[model samples]
Target: MDVRELRNCFGRFATGVTVVTWKTDDHEYNGITVNSFTSVSLDPALVLVSIDKKAKACQALENRPFVVNILASNQEPIAWQFAGRPQEKLTLEWEETEVGPKIAGAIATIECIPWNAYEGGDHILFVGEIKAFSYNDKDALMFFKGKFINN
Candidate 1:
């Protein structure tokens, strides 16, 4: 199958939107919108996020602690912001944590340390060991079939 076909097949599965935030070696903040976040192991409290090899945040993730901000239904603009679409007059609300900076209004936040990274074709699969986590009762922002939707 072609790339478009594979992408369409993958898009059939609904996924929660997340913004993975990390600081570079120079203390520069970096964040990228990701939908490929998943829980890896329970005993070790591990999570995984796939980052495109070409993403700016991909290089910054090496050996860095990061926070995964699970976007709430009302945070679509925030998602788009980190996804490389800058909005005019947008002011971001950042909550500094021991692991990294997290979006202030996220429904859930997971703070993690770098555990391992593996080659995944065009993407890098980063496994993180969860150090802390919190969640609220808000609905999550979801993506399916190339569009955001409320469930």
Candidate 2:
């Protein structure tokens, strides 16, 4: 099947949008908008996030801690900003965590330390050992069929 067709088929399964934030060795903050966040294990409190091999976050995450910020429904602009589409007049607030920096107002936040890295086709699968997490009861931003949806 063509890649586009395969991607469209995959898109049939909707996913929540997340921003994977990490601190550079130089103390800089970087992130990427992702939809491939998943809870891998409950017993060990592990989560997984897949990032394209070429994304800067993929490189920055090496041996560094990161936060998976589950976007709230109203935070679409933040999502777009991290996804490489800058939104005019976008402003942000951040909170420093033991693991990394977190974008405020997310529906949930998962702070984790890098546990493992694996090679995946065109992407890097990062397994995180969850160190801390927090959540609020809020609607989530979602992605489906190439567009953003708030639910």
Candidate 3:
């Protein structure tokens, strides 16, 4: 099967949008939009975010603390901005956390410490041990069939 066809097939599954943020060794803030995030374990409070091998943030995430900002329905611009489509000097609102910067209006924010990394074909699966997390009662930003949806 063609790659695009396989991708489209995968897209049929609706998933929440998230931005994974981390700090560099120089204290620079970096983030990337991802949908390949999920809970891995409850006993150990673990979660996972899959980053494309070629993405710059993939390298930054190695052995670092990071936050997963689960986008709210109104945060599509934040999603696009971090996804590498900067819209002319967009300013992001952030709240400082012990782990990293959390998007101010995200429906949920999960802070984690790097636990393990694994080979995932063209992507790298980064598992994190959850350190802290919080959530709000807001609609989530979702992706399905290659488009963002608020529900």
Candidate 4:
């Protein structure tokens, strides 16, 4: 199948939007938009995120610790900011955890250390060992057919 067809097939599965952030040296970097996140194992409290192998964010995450910010429904603007949109500048407040950084307004935040990575198509699947986590009883930011939708 062609790439577009593959993308369409994958888009059939709805997903939540998240901004995965990480630090490189002293500089902080983040992926503005991602739908490739999932809980891996509850026994060990592991999570996984997939990023394009060629993306700068993925490159930055290599061998580095990171955090996943599960956005709230109202965080569409933040999602856009991370998705390379040229718009009014936004400054997000965040807190540091033992493993990584987390956005303050996120519905949930998980800090994790890099556990392992595997090559998959044009992307890399990163498994993380959860170090810290937080959650709020708020609606989640969702993605469908390339757009964020409130549910």
Error of 3 at 75 (Å): 0.4
Error of 4 at 91 (Å): 2.6
RMSD of 2: 0.8
Q: In candidate 2, which residue ranges exceed 4 Å CA deviation? A: none
| lDDT of prediction 1 | 0.92
Q: Who is ahead in TM-score, 3 or 4?
A: 3
Report every candidate's CA lDDT: 0.92, 0.93, 0.93, 0.85
Candidate order by decreasing TM-score:
2, 3, 1, 4
Give the residue spans of candidate 3 off by over 4 A.
none
Model 1 agreement with the true structure over 51-71: per-residue lDDT tens digits: 999987888898899999999
lDDT tens string, model 4, 85-126? Answer: 844867778787777777889999988998999999899999
Better model by lDDT, 1 or 2? Answer: 2
Of 1 and 4, the candidate ahead on lDDT is: 1
